[model samples]
Structures are given as structure tokens and as C-alpha cells.
Target: MKSKILLNLSLFALLISSLGTSLHAQTYGKNGMVVSDHHLSSEVGVSILKKGGNAIDAAVATALSLAVTHPEAGNIGGGGFIVFMKADGDVTTFDFREKAPLAASPTMFLDENGEIRDNSNHKGLLSVGVPGTVAGLYQAHQKYGKLPWGELVQPAIDQAKNGFPMSFGLYRAALQVSKRDSSYDILQNFFRGPDGEVVAPGELWKQPALAQTLEAIRDQGRDGFYKGAVAEEIERYMKANGGIITQEDLAKYEAVERKPVKTTFKDFEIFSMPPPSSGGVALIEIMNLMEEADISKIEFNSTAYVHLVAEAMRRAFADRAEFLGDPDFNPEMPIDHLISKDFAKSRFENLDLTQASKSDSSKFGQLYGGDHTTHFSVIDKDGNAISLTYTLENSYGAGMGSDKLGFIFNNEMGDFNPVPGITTSTGQIGSDPNLVAPEKRMLSSMTPTIVAKDHKPYLVIGSPGGRTIINTVFQTVLNVLAYDMRIDRAIEAMKIHHQWLPDRILYERNLLSPDTRDALEAMGHTLIPTTNIGVLMGITYDARLRAYVGAADSASEDGAAKGY
Candidate 1:
């Protein structure tokens, strides 16, 4: 362990210095590509492809590497979903989303007065669900990987062991952690030195403990994380903290294979994550609503076009609030009826082009999700494409890390409705469908999507933003297919989000001209200005050119898209 640690440090110092100097904006690429939020992670995917691994193998490598390099959100200590398409046209979804422990109750986060409890739901170990990333990656590899699982995981192990230079984004996240959860475990255990100073950009940061953990997983598969020493560490951490996770929860955790939600928009057939993730249903619904409106005549991002898209977003998110949840927990949800053309037409007709509809006014024709997620898109030469999105929910999730193990835990429990009846502070009605239940998977806004035309992949896209994920993805698709924007332009374009109850349009400050914002306001739209909502990454396949156009969001300076 000691020798490996020292060797890792030396190698990391040499490698990061070389790579760090080359850090700059990456644009479109073809042949084979991996587009991710971090350059190192993207390179890891590219290396896998060069080694003869397929898109699935490259995606797993990128995901693991992100967990080490982009620790604020990317995670092995949390869970997420993977949407995959094989060259033969087979499509599937793997949901390794975290689950509520058996010991949990719907009202666990509610106080004696039946009010929602603060901090406990999202700031401690109780918020950490049974993580499924390891299992999810293993399951996907078992079915589609061209390389051995150990090989796919090694790059991340080396990254964590050898350390990497801190990027500005990660440095900012660390500073935020210091401000909000300064007393949190991460500060004391890993992110900070004995002097209590956070690591800054250009500094070498290593995770010897995380490296050891990754090695264990590489050797023992799922059991390495869920059933043995790692599990004991988790249990030990929870017992010492105020968490409720148990050895049983970790030992019994399983990643399930679910059907990808499939829909058609114009010339493309879109496949995305199913329930447990509200993304697919909502994305389809938004697309359907847009299809009903003749917005193609309007300029993209013009006042009129933005208004139509925002209204569609409002309607879809309203449905998301009322109907979506864990299928196992809510068996009566009208999954088919919600995504049907007839339902979408009715919702679309309810919208008035001249005015906005109150979120409360949308009748529950019934559908839908939130998360601070990370997404990566990979397209290999064999035509296999994987769009995977995962998260640790919130930057430095739960603001806590294990002293023994060296990764932060997710605050996904915050995704559930703390109070099942009355509406809470966020404006949406109190959520019942997504209320906590023992062993129930939490609702998610992660939409790892693939769009195909003529049975060939046209675009692969997804993003990371808490509630904005669905809309960021929704608008990006429209920007490309409808507005005919290039893949890079589509991702880099300004974005907007509306999650129903707030009854307000949140948009990127720079994207919408002041006149457009004024025009929308005149139309009775409540506008809130902000920076970019989501950090999107994607790759568009050009069959005619037989190449891939890998694109990363311009808003994310650390993002990269590499090809060879």
C-alpha cells in the first residue's frame, strides 16, 4: 500500500503537469468519441476505445474516472442510470439508483408536529442511500463490455492513487464545502490537510483510501463494495454518525435492468431512463407538446420560441410533480397514458401562445423528477453508444465523506418529499407519489438519452442540474433537431428551466436578450435570471460523414470532448 501510494504520487505529478498545460476548450470530433465534464475522465474513455473497448466499456471507465477526478458530484458512493444502444439496435436501461433503507419510513424526516425536518433529510448519513454504482457498472459490463471489468476500473484507481491537479471547478466546489459544511467529514478526513486548508487549483490531490477501495472493487466485483470490508466501513460510519444504513442494506443492494422509455419525435426514436427517473416521460411529453406547436417558423431563442418552450416545460413538470415515482411503490401510475400522443395533445392545447398557464391550473392528465447529476456520452466505431448520468446529489453530497473510505455520500434522500401532505417551501404541492418508502428507489431527473433516425443514432445527449436536467436535455434536443443547430451549438446554447409550482422561468442571463426577457415579461411570464442551469455534454453521429461530433457545454470550462 505504501509503495503504491508513493509511486502514484510521482506518476500523477508528472502526468497532470503535462495534461494540465494542454487544458483548453475542446470542440467537435469523430471516428470515436467520449464527451464528459472533465478532461481526464474523457481521456480515460478515449484510452479505453483505443484499447479495443466498446462504448459501454469506455462509458464505465469515464464514469469511474469522474468519481475520482470530479468528486464533488461524480460518485461511486451514490447511484444513477445508464442508457445503452447496441449496434444491432437493441436498447436497454440499467438503474443502479440508490434506494431507501428498509429501516426508513415515509415520515422519518417529519417532526412530531408533522413538519419537515431540516438538515437531517439532506445533510447527514441518513441522506445517503444504498449506493449502486459499482453494481450498475458491473451489470452493464457483464452484458456489453469488450474489456475485462478490472481493466475498465484501473484508470480510475490510478487517477485516485496518483492524484491529479485540482481544476478550477473542483477548487470552487471545495471552497463551497468549506463555507457550508465546514464541520463536515470531508474537511476533516480528506479534502483538507492537517492545517485545515482546502487544496487549490494546480495542487496535487490524491486519495489513497479511495484507491484502496477501488482496488478492492476491481478484485472482488460488487461484493468488494457492498458485502465486505467496504460495507463494514459504511456501517461503521453510519453507526457513529446519525445515519440509519445497515450491513443488510448494503449486502442486499442490487442494480435492476429496466426497459428504456421509448418515444418518437419527428424523424427520431428517442430512448431514455424509465421510472425511478422522471426524465424519460417528461422529456417525451415536452417533445410531444413542442411538436403540436408550429415553432419552427420562429427564430430559435427568440422571444416567441423561448416562451413556447418554457410553457411546454411548465406543463411537463406539473405532470412530473403529481404522478411519477418508484413503479414498485406506486403500481397504479398511468405510464402509457401519460406518454401517449392523445395526452400530450390535450396538454398542448391547454397552452395559450399569448399567455402562460399557472402551474396549479394544469389538470392532472398525469405523468413525471430532481438531481445534481453528471452525464457522459460515448460513441464507439462499432455503432454502440452509451449516454450515462449519475450523481452524488448536490456538490460534495451531504457534505460528508467516510474517514476510512475516501468518498462523499449522496444527499438523495432530499429528493423525496419530506412531508407527504401539505406543500413545502419549494412551491410544488407536497409529493405523495415520491414520498419515502422502505427500499423504494427515489425519483430522479436524470435523462441519459439517445435519439436515432433511420435506425441510426442521430444524437446522444444528457446534462447535470438539479431540477433543470429535464429541460436542459429537452431544449438541447429541440435546439439540434428542430432548430437545426450544430451539436456543439446545441449544447452551448443558453438554457431555461421551469418546474411547475414556482410559476417562473429561470433562464441563463446572457442567452436571452434584455428585449426578449422584457417581451416575455409583458406576456405575463415571471422571469428569473441566472447563469447556465445545466452542464450538458453530447455527441452527434453523422452517418454521411461516418464520424462523430463530440460536444461539451461551453459554460463548463472543464468539459472536454475527445476523439481519434
Candidate 2:
């Protein structure tokens, strides 16, 4: 008995040591906190908070700064969603999701014989959507920001004009895009130096044109980009490049304020972006399905837990592809039914604890979104919190940029169904709900979500992973709310994804133990390995310490968590 007691004591000590190490990886702040894909962007946000700006102001600054620092995903040329929760629990969401051009059609990407034309939906000029980031940010600021807009915009302009040290991640991304075909010549030239080589890590990289555009925005607000000289420049570039976005589209663009989707799991209240973004609905559905199980009894990351969660993800994604779309376009979508606990229970009526469920593509649509998006979380001293996610559809967008503007345009139109009735095994969906329509926002999986406990903001989290965004956010929330994990542990934990089509589970490399893998395979699961899953930015309120604990995913080399 004495020996056994000593062994247990040693085990407890080791557990505490491990937890301390994990906690050390996080940044804590009593006043405000920001976590983003780039260290400089995070720092920019923290500076705003220190200047007495609230979460909304810090979020805008962080996003704009990322447009300069993390060009691969952040941009004024892209659009996305934002979920904000005030100290009093007042919740709202902004949908600045990019919209299809006025000239776009349901079958625009199809050729004469109804086949896809040179992957036109995903490449070159026509792929671009009318940008919404600037409008979105402007609207949010106008409604909730307390700081001057110019103050929020200045940091980004300075970063672009004076330049910042190039990160290895940025350098690598630029080098790869530079190697693309001549179509990306302008992009190549923008990143290449006088010696004609890609900018090296730690080297200063500047964008004078982008600086001038930012100056216009800082001076004129939304019109700076959507109306005057900048808009004219975009129209001229499009006309010369066979693109369809025009000055009219730019002028007509506006970000809509939508009611956030709210749901409850146990003692927590969750709020996320609504349709236009499939993220909120899908995330709620998956969580509802998960709520039926006593997950506390299951070992974390065990085959059983993974299998159960994957099944839930599969069902939710199946619903996502079939019914969800821009709410303005598909108003009758069964959102209520999809997110109900009864619906989740009915969907899981069949008990299959021993075998993996088969994902039938014919019965559901497949995902066709890109993994190159960015997400950031910010919380202020006033207890207001923001979860914002933006994307360019693909890495470096269409692998090109406008020489005059010095910014990449999103290939967001590719997120729309390329053809009607053409769902493919390789993850292509042709659901009517998401078919291209002039001025329609493309469906997205950018799930920026916040959780509140006892009517106070507890967790502000989001990730950039295309179709896997929903699943990643779901798992991280579960790790904290259900499994009682530390915020840092929750962010670093390996994640898995199952998107209903292709019928395979995508697990992070070495995420599963050999025994767990063999057991899962024995249960008829086809598991594929991926290098990484999502780059998450998250903050959790530590009530005992009375501080905000922020963590940036280890998967992102340049990610940081900053606070004051």
C-alpha cells in the first residue's frame, strides 16, 4: 500500500508538471489579449487595446495589420465573418462575405459541352469576387468602435510603407507563388528583389502601392477603397485582365449585420456567425449530436471518442452541403431543425459504436473551399470579445495580384458550385443552395465563435481550415467545455476531420496511437494522414487568475499571442 501511494503521488506530480509546461506556452493578460496568425498583427492589436480601444477596435487593427504582414490569407481584397459579444451578452455578427459579380451565372464556369473550362472558377480574373473586407470592417467600427478609424488604419499603413522583417513562412509562400506560371508575373515581381530573388527571411519587405491604398482608406474610410482612386485602379486592372468586377460592384457592396446563431451546451452559451457561413449551423449541429453522448466517460483521443466525433461531423457536413447557403438567398433553409437537439438525436438513432458510418456522396454535397484563411480573437478590459475570420479562398488567392494595387484578389467565386448536378467523389458539390448567382455571397466554413459561461465571455476562438474549420472549432470547444482542458492544451491538441464525402477521416500526423489506428481500421474506417489540421487563435478567461489566457496554434510558425 505504501509503494502504491508513492507511485500515485509521482504520477500526480508528473501530471502537474506537464500542465505547467502547457500553461507556460500561453500569454496572460488582465486587461486585454489578442491572438493572431502573425506576431506583428497580434502586437498591433495589443497596442490598440493599450491605447484604450475596445475589442472591436483591436480586431479591426489586427485584421488590417495582417493584410500587410500575413498576405497569404488576410486582405482588403477578401471578405469574411465576425462574431461579437458585448459585456452585457448582447451578440451580433457581421457578414462581409464576398459576393458573386453581377455578371456571374450558375453555369458560367462550364464550357460549351457543360464541362468545366480550364478550371476557370478557381483561376485567373473571373474567379475574383467583389471584395467585402473593407466594408465589413468599416460597418463594424461605425457601430461599435470607440477609437478613430484612422488610428486603427495607421499601423497597417506604416507596416506597408516602412516595411517589416520578412518571416520564413512569408518568404516560403512568396517563393512558391513566384514559381507559378507567367500569369502570376505581377505577384512574382512584387516579392522579388532587385537581384530578382524571392525576399529572404529577416529581410525588409515593403509595399508602397499598398501603403498608398491604405492611406486612401485611412483618409476616406470605406470610400477610400470602394469609391475613388483605388476603385478606379481595380476596375482598370480588371478590364485589362478579363475580370468582371467593376466600379459599380465595388460601390454597391455593403456588409450586412446578421443576428448571430446562438445555442446552448450544458452550462455554456455559444454564439457564431449565421448562414452565408455554414460554420455556425454546422458547428451547432455537431455539438448537439455530441451533447447526446456522455463524452466525459470516454478517454480523450481514444478510438471511440474520435469515431464518435467523426460521425457527428459527417452528419453535420452532410446537412451543410445539402441545405445551408447565404440566408439572403436561401431563406427557407431548415436551420432550426438542423440545430435542434431532437434532430441530432434522430440523425444518430442507429447505434454503431463498433463501426464507422459510411459517407455517401450521392446523398450529400462535397466541400470545395480552400484552406488558406486567417482567424483572430480579441478580448478587452471591458469584457467585450470578438472572433473574426477572413479568407482569400486559396493561398495567395489566384496566385496573382494587381501590380497597381499590390494586393491579392480572392478566388472566392470558386467556392460556389462550378456546375449544377455535378457532385464529384473528389470533393465537389453542386447543391442548388450554393449555385452562383449575381450578387450572392458564396457559402463558407469560416466559423468564428465565442462561448460564454454565467453570462460572461469565457472563450473566444476560431480557425482557418476551409471545410475543416467547423470540426476544428468543435473539437477545441469540446476540449475546454467538455473535457476541462487548459486553453493552451485545447489549442495544441491534435484534430481530425470528416467532411461527409470521400468517406475518409483526415487525422493529423501521429494523432492516433498505433493501437488506436489499428482498432479504428478494424472498425472499417479509412483514415488518411495530413501534415496539419488548422491554425487556431484562441483566448480563454481564467476566472481564478482573473486574466485572459491566449494561445496561438503551434502549427503556425509565425503565430503569436499578445496581451497587456
Candidate 3:
């Protein structure tokens, strides 16, 4: 068994090296591990673990650091969810998903003609949601963190104040956002150097303003961001720009502790974020449907396997569009029914193994979400694990940032259904469950999940892909638990997505052979080729090695798995 484990480790390292990038190799540690899309952030997290901080402490520190190093998605100006699992199996979730402002209404994005105006729902100050990252992190730390709050935040402040070398990924992202939306002077000033050129890769990019903001948070905890100086600055910016967010909206924001959605797949218990994230419910629903089949009997990524999984995805996503939303707003959302094994069985009963299911948009709402988000996974020696995903919706969010605040704001308002009754074949959903309302969190596909066996964490995993997030996580979990693949191999494996409304299977380019593609098409499945699906950060506990093994998806240009 030890030799086999060694062989598997060797194979994993070989695969990493063969990826043709300077990516970090699959990492292993007896004490702790952190896997994220940025090497610096991963190192910061591992440093916290070495300081005797638990997984939660490491998570807070890691997230804070990413806000400095990886601005594309890692953000204090955004919000997300956290799925936490203690070694003894106690599980909980924190919902800090950005909320619609008090002044937001169902048709706020519509113009005089009742159509979306200037893409207002996704483009400017009006698109920004109430920030929640600071509140969520602080709340989690207050309850479970062992390190000083100041200590966790200090690293981010230092990174921003002292500056860090800009990576090619960061440089490219900054350039892309600037070019995509040239109207935001804030973004232009932030990305451009003294010569009026975009900051080049490897240059030391400093953010003194962000550092000052972090310093306040470090000194005052949650109130630092939500109540005093930062809140006032945010209000001033909004009012000056015709945006609606106010000091009251910022002050009223609170991250809520909620029960995690729990379900069993074979011998493993899965825990993930619940509603206002459709992730957990949809993931379990898909898994439960897949559980009915002997997946092992079918070859991985074969036509038959893809068909079965896509069918499952189709049915689950249909349910997600119709029934899932913020639990606070839709108390009767059939949570139990949606995740139940019986429900999955019934859904699977209608799945034709040889035919593709039609995704009628009229029957289910279309998904409107940004494909840019960040996820990190951490586990300490004590077996505590955290799977957290956050985003500034649509890379760099709203293409705007505050020179005074030094952080971008989330355009998360776009996640809400914009029109009241406008479900369209072109993939626009007007589902009432996700309509904008005061303080209502928009529905999300950010599924931070932990899979456990025998009351200990076995796998901690998540990804960043908007509507594809749930499916990406679903496939990864299945890759490990069902197909018996190592965590690294599971992450590197090709992925596919099938959201209900699109009625198409999106497969990673070049993975599906011509024959397989032909076969799928023969079954009436519309196969669309795409680039990498998600940048998955995952860690698994190797019971045989009595250690944690981590993997950062090869698709991620700057991702790393750090451990100590």
C-alpha cells in the first residue's frame, strides 16, 4: 500500500511537470496545506498554519492576502461563502454573498422603454452590491479563529504597502479590464504606470491606499470597514457618481451564519454552501442522480458517461432555476425535496440514457453570472478544513475601483434576474426567486465543499466559474470519490458543463475525441468546445500517509499548493 501511494505521488508530480508551465508541483505536508490561485497567498496561509493557527485562521489570512495579490477576483469589495468542517464533523457555512442595496428594485436596471438600459445592471456604480467580505471574515474569525485578527490582516497591509512583484497573470488581467471598459478613469489610473502604460509584469505594484484601508480593518475589525472611514468614503463615491449604495447600506450589511447543506454520496458525506447559493443543492441533486448508476462500470469521459452526467446536470439545473434562491426570501424553497435521494431518483427516472434532454428556457430561467471568481482550500494538522470562494463579479468588477479606497467593487447585482417576466431563449432569466430586493442576496453558483468519511475531512474543494462552478465542483468530487483518482489527477482531468437553459454540453477543448463528439451529437447533444472550465483548488487528506495533499489546477497560470 505504501509503495502504491508512492507511485501515485510520483505520477502526480510527473503530470505537474508535464504541464509545460512553471506551476507549483502537487504539494504534501504532514501538518497543513493551502492551495489557491496565487503562490504568495498560498505561502501566507501556510505561514499562518506554521504559527499554530488553525485552518480558519489560515483561511482568513490567505483570503486577505489574495485581496492584495490577486485583484481579479480576490476582494474585500466583493462577497462569497465559506464551508467549514471541523475534524469531528461539525459543519457550518457563512453567507456573506453581496446584497442588493435598500434602494434596489426588480426593474431598477430597466429604462423608459422597459429594456435593460446601457447594460446598467452590470456596468457602473449602480451595479455594485453592498460589500460583505470584511464582515464575513471577521465573523468567522470571531467564532473560530485562534490568531489575533490584527495578525491575519497585517500580512495583506504589508503586501499592499510594501508592494509585491506583479505576475504576468495580474498584468494581463489589469490590461484586459482596462481595455474592456475604458470609461472608468479609476481603473485606468489604477492599472497605468507613471508613463500612462499598463503596469508591466514583474514590476513591484504597490497600493498604499489599500494598505491604509487594511490597517483600519486590522485596528477595528469589522466596524473598520462597515462603520467609519471606509463606509463614509464608499458613500461619498456613490453619491458623487449617481450610484445608490449609502452609508446605511454599508452599515446594515451583516454576514450570516447558516446551516450547510449536507448529503451523502456512497460512504462520503458532502457539506457545501446552501441557498442563496444554488451550488450545494444542485451539486447534491446531480450526485444523487449519478449515484443511481454504476459509474465505475463506465469508462471515464466516455460518451456514455458524459451523457449520463450531462443529463443529470440538465435536470438539476432546471430545478435550480425554478426553485432555488435566497432562503430568507423564499422560505418554502423545497430545500429538502430538492436534495433528497428520492427526488434525484425521480429526476433520473426521466433521463433517457441514449437521448439528450431539451433545456427549454421557457420552462427554466437562464443563468446570468460572471465566470471570474476565486476559491481557496485549506486544511491543518488538527483536521479542520475550509473551502472558501469569493469574487468581484466579472473580473475586476464593474471595471471601477476607488482611488481613495484602493479596491474594486462587486457588480454582483448582475446576478439577479433583471427583468420581472422575461425568460428568453437567448439565455436571459427573469425568475422571481432571484429578483432584486432590499438586502436580498443574489443566487450564486459558488460551491465551496468538503467531503468527509468517518467524521474527518477527506476532501476540500471548490472552483471559480460562475454557472459552471457547481458542475466543476461536482465533477471533481466525483473524480476523487467515485473514480478513485488522486486529488491532483482529479483536478487535472478534463471537465464538462451543462447548465439547463443552454441545452448544450460545454466540453474542454481537445479532450473529447472526434468519435466521442460525433456520438454525443448523434444523441442530439449540442457539443460546444471551450477553454478551461474552472481553476479548481483542492486538498485531500491521505489517511495512508497521514498527511494532507494539495493540488492547484493546471489551468491556473499562477496557482500554487503550499504546505509545511
Q: In model 1, where do residues sit more than 4 Å from their true spots?
A: 1-30, 179-182, 193-197, 361-371
Error of 2 at 403 (Å): 1.2
Q: What tens digits encode model 2's per-residue C-alpha lDDT throughout 227-308?
A: 9999999999989888999999999999999998878998999999899999999999888877887677889999899899
Clash counts for the predictions, in order: 3, 0, 0
> Against the correct fold, how does model 1 do in TM-score?
0.93
Q: What is the TM-score of candidate 3?
A: 0.95
Q: For residues 1-564, could you state the per-residue lDDT of candidate 1 as single tens digits?
A: 999888668666744643432433445555589988888899999999999999999999999999998877788988999999888888999999999998999889878888767757777777878888999999999987889999999999999987787766777777766666454766554666546678766666788889999999999988889988999998888898878999999988889999988888777898988899999999998888877886677788888888899889888877787898888889988888878889988987778989877655333322223346789999898888999999988876777867678888888987877666656335634567888888998888899999988777789999988778988998889888888888877877888888776678998887789999999999989999987788889888766777888877766657788898
The C-alpha TM-scores of every prediction are: 0.93, 0.95, 0.95
Candidate 3 lDDT by residue in tens digits, 1-564: 999887656655543442445555678899999999888889899999999999999999999999998888999999999999987889999999999999999999999899999999899988999989999999999999999999999999999998776666677777776776555747876866667788676555788999999999999999999989999999998898878999999999999999999899889999999999999999999888878876778899899999999989888888888888889999999999989988877887788999997888777854788999999999998999999999998988886766899998989999998988788876788878999999999999999999999989999999999999999999999999999999989988889999887778999998889999999999999989998999999999888989899999987877899888
Error of 1 at 94 (Å): 0.6
